[model samples]
Target: MKSKKKTLNDFGGIMYSTDPSFVYEDKNSSPVEALANNQQDLRVMLDKKNRGGKAVTLVTGFIGTDDELDKLGKMLKTKCGVGGAAKDGEIMIQGDFRDKVLLLLQKEGYKVKKSGG
Candidate 1:
């Protein structure tokens, strides 16, 4: 008796048989390139508002999604050891962390620009 061999097509096509690691690597292979491709104007500003009677550093830009902003805000908060939030598609850190945030954003391959005094 002969047995039949299972091929990728037998499942759901090439994507199903593709190596998961390779898929991930290929997906994230050109993050910087993607960022550049999606580049838009970014404004890093300092805001002093009546809320809580304290000032906060605000970083606003045209990112793809709120998830990205949340992730960036979380990283900045952890690095700066402060509390922060991502709201209205902007990141708000709890201090004057513009310079640090700028450097961090640059490290993440974003073309950052400082705005305001």
Candidate 2:
């Protein structure tokens, strides 16, 4: 999936621009650099804030393209047999699956760590 694009309302700088044709860069404008699988330092944790009491396993600190992030999120969701999404450079898997996600990431050759209690 493609990264979410910011609207004019989301940028403070955009408000001050007088040029009608001026275009602020989308966050994903740059070509994402590919990090070596071994060099990836990913944090896996369960979060409940903003979602009532439900837990969502969040995997953050990914340095890659939206395509790469989506691929990884898809792999994790498939492995865990759950639903989730990837956005803003973070992957949110629905449920507390840190341990399982950690293993999946490790098997994929990424350096994974469990965070939070």
TM-scores for candidates 1 onward, in order: 0.63, 0.77
lDDT of 2 at 51: 97
Q: In model 2, what lDDT does residue 62 have? A: 94
List model 1 lDDT by residue over 49-94, tens digit each.
8767777888876455556667778988998899988867688888
Best by lDDT: 2
Q: Which candidate comes out best when scored by TM-score?
A: 2
Tens-digit lDDT track for model 2 on 37-101? Answer: 99989999999999999999999999988889999999999999999999888999999899999
Query: lDDT per prediction?
Result: 0.70, 0.89
- For model 2, the local distance difference test gives 0.89
C-alpha lDDT of residue 96 in model 2: 89
Runs of candidate 2 exceeding 4 Å displacement: 1-30
